[model samples]
Target: MRVLLVEDDQFHASYMEDVLAETLPEVTEIFHAMNGEEAEHEARALTIDAVVMDLRMSRRNGIDAARTLWMERPETRILFWSNYADEAYLRGIATIVPEDSAYGYLLKTAPRDRLKLALRAVLVEGQIMVDREIHRLQRRAASPRNTLDDSEFAVLLDLAIGLQDRIIAERRGMSLRTVQNRLLSLYEKLGVDDEASDAMPLNKRVRALNRALVTRTLNIETLETAQRDFDRWQSTRKRA
Candidate 1:
C-alpha cells in the first residue's frame, strides 16, 4: 500500500519512515511531505492509499489539510499523529470528518508498538483508534447539555480573543441577541455561574475562558488558530 507521511521535522519524519517501513509489510511506497501544504500537493499528485498526518505544521495544520482531502475523497484514511491531544484539535477534527469515515488520533509520545497498532488499525483494518484521553474528551463533547455546540464554541473563541459581543455578532453574521444567548450557554457549559461571593465581581466571560483553558478545552494552539483567522479577516476588511 502507498502511504503519505506528513510531518514538519525532518529527523522525526525519517524516524517515523523507518518505523513504518520496518513494521508494516504492506506498505510499498511511503510518500513524504514536510508540511500540510506539501501533503495536499502530494495527495493530489500521487495515488496515496492512506496517510499518517502530523497535526501542527509550518504552512497549514493537519486538520485543515485532512478536511480538504476528505472533502475531495471521503474514503481517505488518515491516522493523525501529533504531540497534542488538545480539545481544540479534537473539535476541529470532529467538525470535518465524514460520519462513516474511518480515522485515528494517536499522540507522538505513544510507544512504537502502539503507533504501529494505530496505523495498522486505521490504514489496514479500517478502524477508528483515538487516544484514551482524547476519546474521553470526545465523549464529554458529545453530551448536548454540558458541551458547547459549534455556535457556542465560536462565541467562546471570540470572547477568549477579547472581542466584544457586538463585534462577534457582526463577524459571525449572528444577531446581537444570538451572540449573547450563545455566551450564556457557553458560561453554563463552562460552569461559570455566580461569582457573587468573591471579593470582587468577576467577569463571567473571563471566568469561562479561564475555565476552558484550565480544562484543556482551549489551548494556545486554539487561540493561535483563531488569531490567524482574525488577522485574515482584518486584512480583508482593510483591503475592502
Candidate 2:
C-alpha cells in the first residue's frame, strides 16, 4: 500500500509517518506534503493507494484537495484527520463524494488503536469510520428542536464545535454575511437574543442539540410503546 500524507505541522506529519510505518508494514512507500496544494500536485503526479489528509491547512484545505484528487483519480481512497468534528465539515465532504467509496474521518485526538482500526477498515473493507465524537455531533445535528434548515443546522454544528464563521462559510459555500444571518436566525428561533449572553453558549447549544437528537431517535410513539411494554413486564414479574 502506498500512502500520501498531507499535513502542515512537521511534528504531526513525522509522527503519522512513523505510526503508519509501524502499523502497516505492508505499506511500501509513504509520500508527504505540507499543504493541500502540494498534496494535489503530488497526487496528480503519482498513483497512490490512499491519502491521509489534515482538514485545516494554510492553503487549499483538505476538503478542496480531496475533491480535486477524487475527481481526478476516483480509485484513490481518502482519510481525513481534523481537530474538530464539526457537522459542516462532515456534511461538506459527504456532498462531494459518494458513500460507497473508501473514506474515513478521524479526530486529531483519536487513540492510536482506533486510528489503526479506521485505516484498516478503509483500506481493507472500503468502509468509512467516523471518530466517536464526530458520530455524536452528526446525531446532534439531526435533532428536531434545533428547528434549523439543513444548511443552517450544518453551520450551527460547526459553530458549536468552535469553528470560525469564515471557515464555516467557506465549507458551506456561503458568504460570511449569509453565515452570520443564518446564525442569527437560528439563535432567534432558539430564543437566544444576545450573543454576549451566557444563555446560549456553544457547549450548551451542543448539549441541547444532543438531547433533541436523542429524543428524535427514540420517536415519541416508539417511546410510548416501550414504556407500556416495560410497565407490563414489571407487573408480570411482580406477580410471578
For model 1, how does the per-residue alpha-carbon lDDT over 1-240 read when each residue is reduced to its tens digit?
Answer: 999999998887998999899888999999999888899999999998899999988788898789878988888899999988678888877878898888999888888888888888999899988888666656765465667778999999989999999989988999999999998878878878754346777789889989889877787767877887788887997898
Off-target runs (Cα >4 Å) in candidate 2 are 137-143, 147-240
Per-residue lDDT tens digits for candidate 2, residues 1-240, read: 889999999988988898888778768999999898899999889888999999878767787788789888877778898886765466557766754678889997888888888878776567877788788765675555555577776665566545678867866689999998887767655544433356545544554345433433222222233344345555875798
- With a 3 Å backbone cut-off (N, CA, C), the pairs that clash in candidate 1 are none
Give candidate 2's error at residue 102 in angstroms: 1.4
Given candidate 1, what's the lDDT at residue 209?
87
TM-score of each: 0.78, 0.63
Worst-scoring 10-residue span by lDDT in model 2: 217-226
Best by TM-score: 1
- Count residue pairs with overlapping backbones in model 1: 0
